[model samples]
Target: MHTRKEFLRNALVAGCAIPFISGKDFLAGARIDDFSFTSPFIRVGLRRTYPAFSFFATDSLGQGRLHLSPILTEPPRSKAFTARTYRDSISYFNSPEDIVADWQVKCEEKKIDLISRKPGAEPFEISFSRPQNHATVLGIMREGQRVLLPCILHLPGLGTFIIESRVPDATIFYDVTARESTGETPFVKLRFDGAGAKGTVKYSMRSVTLFPRKKKIHRIPLFDGYRRNFINIFQLNPRLGMLANSSSGDARASTLFLYAEVARVTPPLTKTFTAMDLIRDSLETYISGKQGYGHPGWSGNHESLDSRPSLIIAASYYIKSTSNREWAQKNYPAIKKWGEEMMRKDSTGNGLIEYGYSGNSGSWDSKIGPANWWHTIGFGHEDAYSNILCYRACSMMSDEKIFPQDEHTRACKAFAEKTKQHFFTNFYNPETGVLAGWKSGDGKLHDYYFTFVNSMAIHCGLVDKVKGKEILTKLLEKMKEVGFVDFKSGLPGNLIPIHPSDSGSKEGFQIYQNGGVSGCFAYYFIYALILCELYKPARELLLGMMDSYAKNEFEGKCPNTGMTRVWKTWNGECRGHEGFLADSYHALLVVEGVDPKIPFLNELVHFLNALTVS
Candidate 1:
């Protein structure tokens, strides 16, 4: 067996996910609890009133709550965190109980500073300026054997900061991590077990003006301004093994629509979590039919009927990304259960999973929740949106790498083929040359010229390539005819307005899925165009969104509803909630996922070149 030392040596170089280990065991004797402090946003525990200890954070933004645990610590060069250079740095910040002799602490309204001393040397001080904005900042200064230096830093969402270390001869490594919990114990509640950076946000400084070196130590993709805000929106949470809609707390983690939006993007970090762990948790939650795991993550809600496809797609992505046949071989039985449950949804054998609700006029409110992710509209009974995801899910589950070549896998393949054969004929609205939102149980075609319904069908190969191109062309013409021209705000969910009777609530037009513009679904339209090689329109829309992202318009709240601007109005009014919705930036994946031949290209000309766009 390889020793723990051997594992650390390999992990440090690979940036691989950290395994669960006992930090308490490694640094028990080095701990001393001389000072501690707690707040709703942050809690700090220091050893010897200096920078060596542990802390956890929980934030309640509005009605939602998120817990972060096992936040990074500076362990005294011991078993779990045995990097001599790290433990010897003047910037080493650890647990509050990690008491070092001859250390002193001072507190102020917005600051707490620590100082360390030696008999014949000058005193060293480290201070913190508390969170005063959307993000917290950390300041670090180096001397000898570790010391506390004061600095002001702001971190968004939870209580977070950075302690960067540098030794000229060695690579500075900070084990930054965060763990999560749902506070409920479902049969599949996957809580993080041990310690050593849970690897959520990587905290660091790009540059410190006050430091003597004026150089960066931490290359963190923690919050905003990194990878076009990729880490900020889709950052990891170890306990959930998924990204919540936002760190702001408007929604919980692993909401199916949000999770599905993440389908195309690979896991961003490999330091403490894996996409396999995420998929495993989601599948377990799907089987258990629990609520808090995320919307549609659990199958118990008859009103929210996208559960099966969402679960299937997430799991398939994991298999495809990692090519882990071992996992597929092990979880084949559980995977079959989900496939069977989905097949069972076709009560009529019509090849479409018939939702429980009829989705007829004025029939939405009396039911429990909206049919799928577009929760504002009442979609049910052979819905195009859900069916689009279903067709893809069934096809993916039949992949040789995903499921074994059993009778069940054959059934999945048959289900996919049957769904495709019936799909266009079932939901096509010839009147508008586009797919309808849904076909209700009352034998009605609810055609609103839904943008996402058409875009997704075309994007996913549910519609023939030629027909898909024609449909997209017609949709664009319809968009122009409807006088919708602002690509920066994104295209509306649909062109024609729907009657209130078919909507989840009596929301106004151009508001909250009645006809709102959100990046979450717009990505499908742009990506679909790219798939078709319709470069001009795709580049135009994609670039417009890039401008909006640079200006930070997709996030933050509107003055009117106090809602986050994840979803917006036609004229650029913020109408939706979830102040920092993670799904809103799904559009960013269009740029990140497409490889045109340049590395980290950001200039408009180069970005277009990278995209092969003229």
Candidate 2:
């Protein structure tokens, strides 16, 4: 086996470095935290956060139309693509109702129904027959229309589809045909072959035209005007996304914003709005189910209907702090509905919320061993954490008048009872006096002690003060015995190994998956530590996590990889160097202990104000 010293040496030699933006550029555009100088409204470039996909930009008039052909095209790193543009096609700043109204006005004269359908649990299906498919969507001819339709065809994530068209639809042609060079300006002809007939039909368009008139340029006031350009560069760097992936380093960035917010509550941080904006954005992204939140990601690129109640519960806290009552009302109903619908079923027949789905692990994704199978098979591990969150949401609903006061109280009590019954009776381990991670299919404990399980108990308020402290101490001991951190106090670059026994001894190696540490886990884990008042340990873990991302150069930018500088675990390979939102967000949580931060209070006000104006 390769020694740690040799591995670090090789990684340093092979280390990929991102060039720092110049000082002239830095002062020209510096944000409060890091270096990034672009506005959010403009298109920096297209990037697939996950690998195996490429993004290219196009103009709506079919002019700059590229990548619509059969073979997928790659995006160029040239300045032409990087230059910011006032593209406003995919943005959904306006409420869904307003967007539907706008779409209705535009599609009024079309032959189609032009109805708006929300993607609930069921997926959306669009099918057009040949004769009607040839007809133009609106009275305005295709070329005359001002709207830019981004026709995205995914070869991997999105499944396949069959298209049919006829002769009358000559104006309607597939964007693929436009790729052929017509001597000067290139254009593609649309022709299709069907079971019986072949004619003109345009099924898919391959470009996106950002209507500059409707779109406006805007940026979060994260920095002063002169420092903006430098700040914009960091926005384009994938590191921020990775920082979001940084185990506990996120606390530093988050703390800055929280401190800034506490400093000025009115105008807010006029320099960069990302601090608060991202929280709201994270809230919306997580709650909407449109963005991936739980591990294993979305199944087949489709949004999983399974709602993480904890996310909604956390959002409620963030929202309540901002005093955005209107938003609470607007989102509360959906939160409740999703909770009622998607949560896993408990023994009491009340909905039990569970995280993870198919592809989450072999327990669900593949045929794993019976122990792993039982640990994941049912709705037991989800008890306290899930119900506590639901209780919090219920309490908020009552406070916000989103639900009837009596109903809310009744729901809370019901959930509380279910929580006590399920957890105390089922999950509690008498031998250890701690909650087990999972209650097996046989209803017996999986008999494993996990920090998460204890954290969840604390999060749900199931453990008393004394028990909570004990649990926290045990978790820390468990962390140390497994060799979780290195000499420099850097994380081991993986998740805490779910040790097979309390002794943390090498009785068996089966339980060690990612014993290093996890970025997202650290976010909550640190919070657990803080609540338990394990001050020194929490500080050590937090500072260690921060230093792991620390470069000799910059103060804030975190390395995408933790434990070591290598980005990937594949022989400690390094790919990109940057930070992520999680790093900043977690930082906010940590720094708030030193100082309170009401994240996105102004954005909440702005959104509420806009709604009132509308």
Candidate 3:
């Protein structure tokens, strides 16, 4: 058996290193504090405290609430004021009409400043003027004669200032404002009056750190810029193992796909054992049909095809990415069972799984829509999306080097290729030059130019370069014609709108899955574009998505509740039910190369590329 040091050394040589630390040390040092501060733009935590006026009367034993409000907005109802705790301090900021003033807290010292922006921009302010219009008030009330030192920190375009109580017996009240006056550049002003304290006090603004300082950082590989922000969203809920589908609940399959993808790309950033445990547990839960596993009422529905495909892909990815052959061998039985279950779904023997009203569709529960993941669509009876995933999963499992070389493995390999060929033959819409969303058993096609299915075809190597390029060109044309702007909201799932006649549900038209843009589905399309060598368009979409994510805008609103993390839909119509959808953002790591040539799950990409060429 290899010693711990030996194992680490081996891992280092493999270009990956597992940290050498005891479980206690790992928990104590690497664990993220749950009580960290968060905002639309950032999150921080408090490590220490300084002397401050107490907000409670004698023997008060509860936490004190600090309320902040932007000028021209109501105190509690305004969406402008967003805050979150970090490891060493708390971060608070007001983003009103796109003008942001990020405040950083460290112990008792606080720094506030406005983010610089382009002149005359729609999203951010050009100049800092009109202090009263942009002013923000920080307030805490207590019954006492205690004076609050430096009660307010004001940030104007020109400079920073503070408002404080000059008399010890005065109540604390102050306002921080930014304004532009005639002939003078924009500047900040402090308005003070309450608590016998009476005048504005000018102070110099100093540099402040907006992002939290990491005591022990785990750097993610293969992505940068706003793309990295996706990882930050995942970090927010570290204990959950799988990314929280929303603030309140965890969805299966899609969540697993996100976690597995992240782990595959940057193993160091993920605890492999912990992630595997979560995957195994979820699979067991699905298998056992037991309640109290957080996914109740889902046991009886076998038609919900997403969990099986998602599990197969995730498990295969983990095995390949980490080269953990032992894990693959150990879990081969369970993994094979999942693959067999997916294969058994192909009642037609034509190598595509059929979907019906038996259970949920893909990642979406039945209530959402008729089809799989694109829940609102009428896709069923051999879905291209689920089949593509099934093919990939089978191919990964059948790799002779990755698994035991046996008749079952060989059959799986042959079945994967057969499925790929059938996928192209059945789903390709020669008339539209794109893959049809799904082919019903009744021999009808739900052809809506589903962007995700086409993209996955290209990424998975089921489509040739010429065909892939043609499909993408058509998709771009449709997106442009529809007035679909940057990827802030994410790429629309389908190019053409779902017609009410084709959709069984009224919610399928121009809403939710009907044709609404979903970042969750966009990742695959983006990856497909890159895989097809559509460099310019791919980069444009990616950068546009990143810019949108940074702006954190939802609909026409400046910042929605899900802005802090990735939103499920670009339109911001959905909230906690779909917030922090990690799979959408995790797509960034799928592409890696000077011009983004490589696809995610590098080994799988290599395998599929070779298959296509051959």
Model 2, span 320-402: residue lDDT tens? 45656677667766656654543334433644443332211223322221111112222233433444445444445445333
Give one clash count per candidate, in the order shown: 38, 52, 24
Which portions of model 1 miss their true places by more than 4 Å?
1-226, 235-242, 248-277, 284-289, 293-303, 559-561, 595-614
Q: Write one digit per residue (lDDT tens) for candidate 1, span 1-614.
A: 75533432332233222222233323332344324443332334445433344443323111111233333444354422111122222222233344332333333222333333322212232221111112322222122211122222223333222232221221111111122255321111111111123211111222111111101211211111223244334433323323345322322322454454454454422233333444455555545554443254333256355656777777777777767788777776776787787788898777898887788888767334656777667787888888887788888888886666778878989999999889999998888788988889888999988888998898788887789888889988988888777787677888878887887667788887778887777778987787666666776677566556544567656665666676788888888755455667677666555444532223333433333322
400 Cα displacement, candidate 2 (Å): 5.4
- Please name the candidate that would achieve the greatest TM-score relative to the true structure: 1
Off by over 4 Å in 2: 1-297, 300-306, 342-344, 347-363, 367-388, 398-409, 431-433, 485-513, 552-588, 593-614
**For candidate 3, lDDT tens digit of each residue in 1-614?**
85533432332233221123222222121124322332222222222121111110100001111111111211123233344444444433444343332333332223322221223212211111222212221122223311134322222111112333334433332221222235443322222221112322222223221112222111211111233243322321112222344212344553465566654443222111223344444444444543221122443233555556777777776666667777777778877887787788888788788765422223233343443555456566777887887787888778765677787778778888889777888988778777888777667667887888888788778888788888899988877877665554676677676766456555644455666655665666777776667765665565445444433332111244422333334444553233234455554453431132353334433432343344
Decreasing TM-score order of the candidates = 1, 3, 2
The predicted structure with the larger lDDT, 1 or 3, is 1
Ranking by lDDT: 1, 3, 2
